[model samples]
Target: MRSLVFLVLLGAAFALDDEKIVGGYECKPYSQPWQVSLNSGYHFCGGSLVNENWVVSAAHCYMSRIEVRLGEHNIVITEGSEQFIYSDKVIRHPNYNSWTLDSDIMLIKLSKPATLNQYVQPVSLPTGCATAGTNCSVTGWGNTMSSTADSNKLQCLEIPILSNSNCNNSYPGMITNTMFCAGYLEGGKDSCQKGESLSMDRRNKKEEEGKKEEEEEGEKEEEGKKEEEEEGGKKEEEEEGEKEEEGKKEEEEEGKKEEEEEEEEDKEWKYLMKFEQQS
Candidate 1:
C-alpha cells in the first residue's frame, strides 16, 4: 500500500506546551502582542500573528473550529487586550504529512482583521539564520512540569540553539532539514510539551518549496520537447510513403502504353500480309 498522509482533527485538545514545561516562569498579561492562543473550548496550542488576517502555527495543532485569542495572557481570567474571534479558513502545508510530521506548519485565515493594539500585534520574521549557541525565547501555556496541571497563564523560557552535529547526537537520526534542535542539552528546562509553533525558519521552508517547483517546471519542458520531436518524425515518414506510392502509379501507366503500341503494330502487319496474299 502506498502510504498516504491524512490530516485528522482529534476532538481532544491538550497543549503540547502543556506537555513540555519544567520550571517555566509566568509573564504579565498583554506583554507579547504577537503571541496568540488557539482555543476550541480551552487553549489547545500557541500561534503567532504574522499578519492581521493570518496566524502561523504547527499542523499538528489543528482544531476543527478555532477560536483565536489574541493579546491573551491567562486563559482563566479575562483581560482587555484579549480579542476572541472565529477563524475563516484553515490551510495546512501542501506537502504536510501528519504521519511523518514533515513540514509541520499551518496557516489560519481570520474572518475579520485583528484589531492591532498594544495587546494584539504581529511578529517580525528573522532577517538572517540563527547561529548555534544563540539564546532564543519560547513561550506557551503548557504545564510547568510533567506532574503539574497545564497553566492558565502564558509562560516563557530561554533555550539555546544546538548545533546540528550536537543535536543529531542527542536525537540520533531524527533531525531533518525542515527541523532543528533548540533546547538545553542538560534537559532541565526544555519545552517538552507537544508545544505548538516552535520557532522555525519559515523563510527557508518557502525557498526550498520554490526550488522544487522550478525543477518540476524544467522536467515538464523537456518532456514537451520530446513529444514535439516525435510528432515531427511521424509527419516526415508520412510524406515519404506518399511519394513512393505516386512513383509506383507512374511506372504502371508507362507499362500499359508500351503494351498497347506493340499490339497495334502486330495488327498492321497481319493486314499487310492478307493484302499480299489477295494480290
Candidate 2:
C-alpha cells in the first residue's frame, strides 16, 4: 500500500551538485527523519552532508511529509529507531524550475546536528571550480529504467565529468550551472536522481492505509493469543487443585477410622459403670 499524501510538501532535484555516490551508498528503511527505522524501507534520494546541521539533497527530496533516517542498514520501517528531523527550513536556489530541472537543489537544516559516523560522513563540496571530465560518483535511489520499476536497493553509478557544453548538449536546456549531469549516455544501470518514485500522494495514502490495517491485525492477533493462554492456564491450575483435594479427603477418612478403632479397644469405662450399679 502507498500513500499519495505527502506527509510533507515537495520540491525539485538539484542541477549542479553532481557529487556522485563516491563513497558508500547507504540504503535504509523509511524511518523518521533523524532516527533509524527497523529496516531501510526506502531510498528517497542521495544527499551529502555539508555540515553536522545541514544536508544537501535535491529539493524534490523534501516533502512536508518526508522523513530522514540516519545510521540505517536494511529497509524496514521501525518506529523509534530513527529520529525524525523536521526540515527547519528549506532553501532552494532562487531560480528553480520544476519543468526544466534547472537549479533543482535545496539545503535542509536539521533541527539537531547529525552525528558523524563512518557510514554517515559529509562529502566535500566543489567550491572554486571543477575541471571538465573530472570523475565523480552519483548515488541515488532513482530507477535504473526510466519506464520500469525502481531499484530495490540504494544504487551508485560512476561517470566522468562532462564539460558544461557537453552536458548542455546531452540534456539540452536541462543542465544548468547549479546542476551537473553524470549518468551514462547509453543509459545502462547508471543514473542519479533523488529517491526512486517520488511516491505520489495517492500511492502514499494507500501505503499508509496498508500500514494501519497491518497494525490493527497485529494488535488483534496479540490480544487473541493472550486470552487463549490465560484460559488454558486457568483450566490446568483448577484440575491440579481438584486432584490434590481428593487425596486430602482420603487421608482424613483414614485418620477417623484409626480413632474409632482405638475407642473400641478402651472398655474400662463400661466396667466402672457396672460396679456402680451393683453397689
Alpha-carbon local distance difference test for all models: 0.69, 0.49
As a TM-score, model 2 comes out at 0.49
Worst 10 residues of 1 by lDDT: 1-10
Off by over 4 Å in 1: 1-18, 194-279
Which 10-residue span in candidate 2 carries the lowest summed lDDT? 2-11
Residue 224 accuracy (lDDT) in model 1: 86
Instruction: Tell me the deviation in Å of residue 160 in model 2.
Output: 0.7
List RMSD in Å for every model shown.
13.4, 19.2
Residue by residue across 184-267, what tens digits does model 1's lDDT show? 777677565442333433445567788989999988888888888887888888888888888888888888888888888889
Please estimate how well model 2 matches the true structure, expressed as its whole-model Cα lDDT.
Answer: 0.49
Cα-based TM-score, every candidate: 0.63, 0.49
Q: Supply candidate 1's per-residue lDDT for 82.
A: 82
Best by lDDT: 1
